[model samples]
Target: MPHLTIVANITAKADKVELVKNELLKLVQPSLKDAGCINYVLHQDNVNPTLFMFYENWQTRELWQEHMNTSHVKALNEATEGAIEHVSLQEMTGIE
Candidate 1:
């Protein structure tokens, strides 16, 4: 099966930017250790500090879904409640 690519765009409430970022950062090391993870990288918008993005590559769609279902991810959801302005997730394939 082909690898899966995910683009996760997160926009935080002005006052909650740092909180959101810290929570998101906590996911990195654990996420990278997942069985199917290829590379999980985070980025912050240079011009817009409240904008955070993730570039994740997984071995399969199922594994990516598993990543989302993890306990830490669930906690993250709870921790960031009402602190996020927007979230956009895109599942992608490599054409080249």
Candidate 2:
């Protein structure tokens, strides 16, 4: 299967920016250790600390789906429910 690329955006409530950021950062290490993960990187907006993004590469789309079902991911969802204002995720495949 072709590799998958994921681009995810996260917006946190102003007051909970640091908390949300810390939570998201915690996922990186474990995500990288997952079987099909090629890379899992997190970034923050320069002017807007509450805005974050993730760039991920997985060996297959199924692997990425498995990542979503992991305990850490579920924990993040539950923990940041209100603190996160918006989340946008995009999955892509290279054309060539």
Report the lDDT tens digits of candidate 2 across residue range 1-96. 679999999999999999899999999999999879999999999999989999999999998999999999998998888999999999999887
lDDT of 2 at 94: 86
Clashing residue pairs for model 1: none
lDDT of 1: 0.96
Global lDDT scores for all candidate models: 0.96, 0.94
Report how far residue 7 has shifted in candidate 2, in Å.
0.1
| TM-score top scorer | 1
Candidate 1 lDDT over 70-89, as tens digits, reads 98899999999999999999
Worst 10 residues of 2 by lDDT: 72-81
After superposition on all CA atoms, what RMSD does each candidate show versus the true structure? 0.7, 0.9
Best by lDDT: 1
Give stretches of model 2 more than 4 Å off.
Answer: none
Q: Tell me how far the alpha carbon of residue 59 in candidate 2 is from the true structure, in angstroms, after superposition.
A: 0.5
